[model samples]
Target: MERRSHIYGVMGEFATPEQLTHAVEKVREAGYRRLDAYAPFPVEGLSQALGLKRNLVPLITLLGGLAGGVGGFGFQYWVAAITYPMNIGGRPLNSWPAFIPVTFELTILGASLAAVFGMLALNKLPQPHHPVFNVHRFSHASADRFFLCIEARDPKFHLADTARLLQSLHAHHVSEVSDD
Candidate 1:
């Protein structure tokens, strides 16, 4: 079949989370990988059904925190020992204990900022529009409806076969999403 360039994918709206989850599992079993589900609230075990991997936010946060801590401590050491060395009461110029509080605060700050930014970046936030919004019924996704979309970009996606699969899974409505 000839692929349509303007077609985003085929979307199936389901009545409940259960049906959506089941459809997702069935679609995955049928070898379709590029698919997404939407619901008003979080659905348990939906990630596993979608075959999602572990999140990378924690690792990003750790790296940010380490950078902040190291940078803070290094700055303090540079000022105290190299840039402006002070010898007061025969005390050493490099004071490690005095830098602990600032280092700790900077670490916390960096970790929180990293988490916020990482989450936004990973989720692709600030998106004012998406191809799914072109469907009139998709507005219900924020209310009570659940939806599953099989993207046209998926290697196994064929408009007719995907629509049939969604219909066979007892979808309330199946429609084609347009990229335009």
Candidate 2:
């Protein structure tokens, strides 16, 4: 019925981490949630500024590690007690003590793998392209510039108001990002 462009968001380029952080706080205070920041290096308290807490990766890792430990122990128990039922002189059929090492190792391995995968999934990695890439200045995001993007998907996002807000925040430049 109607054509709509795949506009991802409006981005603001900042000269310093403090400026970006202040802009982020202001945006957050202005009730914009679907936003992100990019910078040349890690900036302390950035996550706090963005109101990010309770990351799920650690929980994923814990559950995966527990599953691995249980699976490993159960496999060993099955092999010793159900499948083969090997018995040495006065030794128990299910030697749980010996199984602990393998179980622990598998637990660590599973946790590590889960951490990696969970982080990837959380960050939505393997994405070949993103709208932010359309900006010529965005390349400097990996160098000395700091960038903040307020996504169109955000319920609070209005093109004119968002651009105005970015300008009020003293952004060096404000540009729209297209999904294409």
Candidate 3:
């Protein structure tokens, strides 16, 4: 584990979602993309303010559903026509109509399962620890406060300048967040 850092970035605490939202917009306009905002509840237009446009979960789910549907249909066709041929009602060997229900059901199931797992994988969930937790009052982010964290990795980041910028946005308090 290599460690050499006194601070992670600057975190600005805000009392309202509006403040947080305005701060995020300003930060984005300031050409800082490495930032995260926290709020007690989902705020309107936050995602837009952050310019988060791409979402891959739905695409994953759709591909999963397609695979399931095709697999279900193929499996049934192979089973009834090749693996175990049984002519109960003299139906055609490649019985596509009979496979429809199972195909639909498996498609639904696969889509739902993919949505759950794909979202977790894409977002890199289950992160039990992070630098933001070092902030003493950050816990209130889930209670009644909003927070904006501008990471040091951003090209526009400068400790003092970022702090001053955040303050200029009317932050209630700006804290020097650490990674240790």
Candidate 2 residue 122 Cα shift, in angstroms, is 1.7
Query: What digit string (tens of lDDT, one per residue) describes model 3 on residues 1-180?
Result: 212277788999999888889999999999899899998898999999999897999999999899888888888999989999999889788878878999999999888889999999998887888999999999999899999999887777888889999999999889988988
Cα lDDT of all candidates, in order? 0.94, 0.92, 0.90
Tens-place lDDT digits, model 1, residues 1-180: 447889999999999999999999999999999999999999998999999999999999999899889998999999999999998998988879998999999999888889999999999998999999999999999999999999999989899999999999999899999999
Residue 9, model 1: Cα distance from true site in angstroms: 0.4
1-180 per-residue lDDT for model 2 (tens digits): 111368888999999999999999999999999999999999988899999898999999998898889988998999988999866896888878899999999999889999999999999998888889999999999999999999998888888889999999999999988879
- What's the C-alpha lDDT at position 154 in model 2? 89
Q: How close is candidate 1 to the true structure, as a TM-score?
A: 0.92
Give the Cα error of residue 103 in candidate 3, in Å: 0.7
**Superposed model 1: Cα runs more than 4 Å off:** none
TM-score of every prediction relative to native? 0.92, 0.90, 0.90
Q: Is candidate 1 or candidate 3 better by lDDT?
A: 1
Q: Whose TM-score is greatest here?
A: 1
